[model samples]
Target: MGTQAIIRPTTSQTAPAQEQNFGDQFLHVFLQDGTPVAKLGCGGSHVLNAAAGQSISNNRWTPITVQYNLPVGKQGGSCMIEIATDNGTAQRLEEYVSHPVSEVT
Candidate 1:
């Protein structure tokens, strides 16, 4: 199996934040054969996103993309890890990226 991850600047916000907290910012998504296993927060999760800020505005989402691959007969999978945070500036218009990885071991 293999995976790739990337981080970049984005200014897309799909929804408004009502509760401003770390716990409330968490988002989860788990898929098995391209189907949702269960409702979010019901148990273990494969994806969780907590970007932007805590407010009812059009804050950025800071989306993270994770790619994974599974062999035909292999029993394991692979994916990449990502970390995103503000640059300690009033306007989050600055970003740094290390090039995209084509594969993961």
Candidate 2:
């Protein structure tokens, strides 16, 4: 059995002020072959892929945590996914970011 965490903005009017127009930004995390994988999307486009051979065991219950630092003026934000098991070190599964872009006139 595997688990997944999907992080995305809610509806436009219902979303928080900071995320209203950025509803198209999303991050997906899931377990594959006992490993954690991630995919990032922005503006309805799949822009980043970090899923690879990162493995975790399915033998015991593990605690997973996701953290994010919201973007600041002209700077990007980042999200980190981690998993920890009893008597083991916490492992970082993935890190996704929303990079800043140049403005076009």
Best candidate per TM-score, number? 2
Question: What are the C-alpha RMSDs, in order, of all predicted structures?
Answer: 14.7, 10.9
**Tens digit per residue, CA lDDT, model 1, 1-105:** 111222222244332212111231122322222221111111123232322221211233333222222111122222222222232111111122232322213
lDDT of 2: 0.39
Clashes of each: 0, 0
- Model 1 compared with the native: what TM-score? 0.19
* Lowest summed lDDT window (length 10), candidate 2: 11-20
In candidate 2, the residue pairs with backbone N, CA or C atoms under 3 Å apart (3 or more residues apart, or in different chains) clash, namely none
Q: What is the C-alpha local distance difference test score of each model?
A: 0.23, 0.39
Error of 1 at 26 (Å): 18
Q: Estimate each model's TM-score.
A: 0.19, 0.39
lDDT by residue for model 2 (1-105), tens:
123232232323222111112345445555544554444443334244443343444344444433322233345554443433332454543344456632212
